[model samples]
Target: MGIYKPKTYMVMISNVEPSTIHEAMTIPSWNQAVNDELQALIQNHTWDLVPVPTNRSLVGCKWLFKIKKNSDGCVARNKVRLVAQGFFQAARLDYHATFSPVVKANTVHQILTLVVSRKWKLQQVDVNNAFLNGDLA
Candidate 1:
């Protein structure tokens, strides 16, 4: 029998996410990503950049960076978002207790598996910061 050699593999990774706006501004792709985030915020009317009010606590904002990958483990796009710190206010003072539920990864995987097996068309909706649609029981 002929000897079988193991295949040599080396993954080339280039999609490191920038941690700060300054870092993101240096790269063309990251800069475009940041611009996209700003446009979305403005289009959605998420918030207004007004002067800081006197004696009022203002929450800090930061940018979060992520690289979207394709099913073949290839870099598809760069995603950037502005997020609030959300930790300056005390409980019940800012606006009662805060609670937000999100979908889990495993559950998403199962749903995707079933859809793929049944050859169903897939549609996705980004529910980030989605307001309450009904009364919470």
Candidate 2:
């Protein structure tokens, strides 16, 4: 019989630090905003959240966090987003229809004018990275 040998083991770690007390307190509030955005995206049918299945193709998402800052060097808030790994998707399988529509600045201006004339509260949201939420597979 051949000589017995023990298998080696390795542990990998990320080069990031844990949240501080200040950050810990602040993070949850920002995460709430992120969660709201994610929910809206789901409700709007922007993307589908599915399990990575075998023998078929699917994209993946990951949650990315970034600390936002104002020009005055103060921490504004934490921004989180979901992003897709688009490279893995097969073009033929994913791109059933490639029709896309574009809006000109004049159209946007008209819409804004209409909103203002209607005196409606126009709430705009800023989705940060918006492509990295979970793992691909």
Top candidate on lDDT is 1
User: For model 1, where is the 10-residue window of minimal lDDT?
Assistant: 128-137
Model 1 lDDT tens row, 51-131: 876656666778898888878988877877676677766765764333333346565577788889999988873544322
lDDT of 2 by residue, 1-137 (tens): 99999995542322232244334334556546567667766765665456766656655555555666668965565555555556666677765322222334555576678889999888863434333343322
Q: Native-vs-model 2 lDDT? A: 0.53
Lowest lDDT 10-mer window, candidate 2? Answer: 11-20
Off by over 4 Å in 1: 1-14, 95-137
Q: Clashing pairs in model 1? A: none
How many residue pairs clash in model 1? 0
Q: What is the lDDT of candidate 1?
A: 0.68
- Give the Cα error of residue 63 in candidate 1, in Å: 0.2
In terms of TM-score, the best-performing candidate is 1
